[model samples]
Target: MALLPTTAQAAQTHPDPRPLTGQEIIHDPTVARLKSGGYVAYSTGGIIGARLSADGRHWDDAGNAFAEPPAWWYEYNDKADPWAPDLSYRDGRYWLYYAVSSWGSNHSAIGVATSPSGRPGTWTDHGKVFSSERTDSWNAIDPAIVRADGRLWMSFGSYWTGIRMVELDPVTGKTVPGAAVHHLATRPDAPYAVEGPYIVKHGRHYYLFASYDACCSGVNSTYKIKVGRSASATGPYVDSAGTPMLNGGGDLVLEGHGRFIGTGGQSVFRDKGKDWLAYHYYDAEDDGTPKLGLNRLSWTKDGWPKVS
Candidate 1:
């Protein structure tokens, strides 16, 4: 892939591009374009770090969502550093789904919180929605949600068993009882390290985007984004080459290039009449400080998503 830049973005001469200048730095972030005509992103850190952008190009630190760490977080992660939050506006309230866990441990949990206004320190933690233990085959950390056909579904996982999905109750934002768990994608080889799955439907297909390889190790990070698609929300997703995602199939959507190392943990949203891919990348030159990454998406005539 040529890694085309968005038409409206300022042109830069790097072979592997970096986001435009200004106050931009984040990791495992999700963007929400507020009705106020600004962008708000929640990333991993203190109650999940927040930043606001008046123009979506320049940002300033907002604050964390929680005034203090929630009581239950210590059971999952004492650091209270919530990870990978998926933010969305639901039922007139802002819904935030975040993960809690210590490093390299399957003892993790995914929690939910709601706020009338989607601003930092305004969230009311609702507590754990799902969790997993070391004995479990899947590590339940990174979380992403999508509303499909009036049903809510969560896609999450990390090392140990790859990505998995469970249907959510739209009203309560919890798992639907008796819902079948779907094991969607995994890398079979050693270092089996696929995580962070986000789903979006365009046309008739539900596209599954997941981060592949390791993350969180700064410049040594090997993370990249890959994708597959299915006709149904409960997927049997296959890559462009027609291999089932269950068998390790995923076509590359974006990867590390030049000074931008470990580009992954992506979220997609349509705003201002254009589709965009929001993610994070390590700045190799900045001693691997994770920074926000945004790239507009343009679909091919045949319906495949390509980074613009």
Candidate 2:
């Protein structure tokens, strides 16, 4: 997953998300490049609201991943609502992983589903993969998967003890039996606000990208994207100056500036040999509407990621 460095991006000015049209409102979005030549995006809402794009620029609503939540979802949230889905293609099928929980409660779970066609209504639910109880220090709300060393790993957590990881059975896409939970990133300060972790391997390192501070507060949201890198999938990740992530160490990647506010909840994907970053940001002009944000990701000469 090595990306060659392109021309250095401008340091002073940052690029805005590419303009989008039709069914633009979404939150905590995850996108998968479909085998059918278009793209489908799933996000937090009614059974996971969906959006589609033919060219990755213009988007349209495509309904949801499920008509109704699975019966088990009620144990966590009475509404049976889901959030922060992660979608990807593997083994000639589409695998979707998502989070289910109510706000401010550590009682949460991550669920999985599969689809022959990565369409909105075609998925088969696989139920809960991993979860956390109120007594657990880590909350299981945001799930992101990465395969390394012929092993499948899922990184997830929020608010309660930041980010954590556990190994998953590739065939089942569920946490391995009796697998030890590994802590990935967290703020040293109490009530750690870091969360929404997405990991990607580029070159020889695995980079952990996460959202920092408060989100879901509309224009007042302070969410921004940050990054730290490690040589191992389960890591003691560190920033450029060698500060460990457990101590609130991270290098700023993207943040709110001007009209685009609260830029976080990010995932990275490869398309046509180039990498792109997908996330959500509050639009200051449109009454703080949460909308999809995309940026072309480039590598710096030093092998770090730079989004333009």
Candidate 3:
């Protein structure tokens, strides 16, 4: 286990993202430290846009993950573009899961793909793993995968009733047929606005991180990231004050600050034995352009995560 940062070090740390250069523009990025060395970031644009970095600080645009969208994607949107991809490595291969949908519509699906290397243009599409329709209370987008107690689970949702989870087949990496949908987090008020769920385990508890409020409105975007923790993977998660996330409980993680406006849509990964938070923010200094945000994630002495 990594040593916990002292309170003095935590106080001196900035909540803003670390300085980055070279092709930093991206949205809803999921970054993975490559087994082959360096890193790759996949995001919600251009048939699943990709960026590569030899060193963690500088990046270069690589290209799209797929040359063309699958035929089924057109059923959700005319352009067939995918969004909010989540990438993970397991079972000796890389698994890429992404969502397809039209804005403001609940007709959506999450699809899976595999690659020997977690690089752009190398993935093989594996069709839909889960989906939702207008009649359903939960929208099937923004997936985050987590493994716990020897079982695989996927947490997803946006806008409708809030965050949800379903078990996945370990062998196929798809939703287990007849698996029950488990509610995770949401606002107590209607039109729940919360989205982009990412869960990470720390010590004895599972922490759920998610974005709350409006996103994608440039400088006006109100996006912010918050978190809660539960003893089990699927939970009745609560904030520091003991308020249930189901009742709008989440400890603030990151919010808009100065040049970094509307920071949210986050994912966490481990690199060189240290955990890092990866997300995007609308840049006020750059006319609200979406740009990558990276920050080292440290644990408090009490075990809660703190982004440095």
Poorest 10 consecutive residues by lDDT, candidate 3:
6-15
Please report, as a residue range, the 10-residue window in candidate 1 with the lowest summed lDDT.
11-20
Please identify model 1 stretches exceeding 4 Å from their true place: 1-18
* Alpha-carbon lDDT, every model: 0.88, 0.91, 0.94
Better of 1 and 3 by TM-score: 3
Error of 3 at 46 (Å): 0.2
Expressed as tens digits, the lDDT of each residue in 183-300 for candidate 3 is 9999988889899999999998999999999999999999999999999999989999999999999998888888888888999999999999999999998899999999999999
Which lDDT value does model 3 have at 30?
99
Off by over 4 Å in 3: 1-14
TM-score of 1: 0.93
Best by lDDT: 3
TM-score of each: 0.93, 0.95, 0.95
Report the candidate with higher lDDT, 1 versus 2: 2
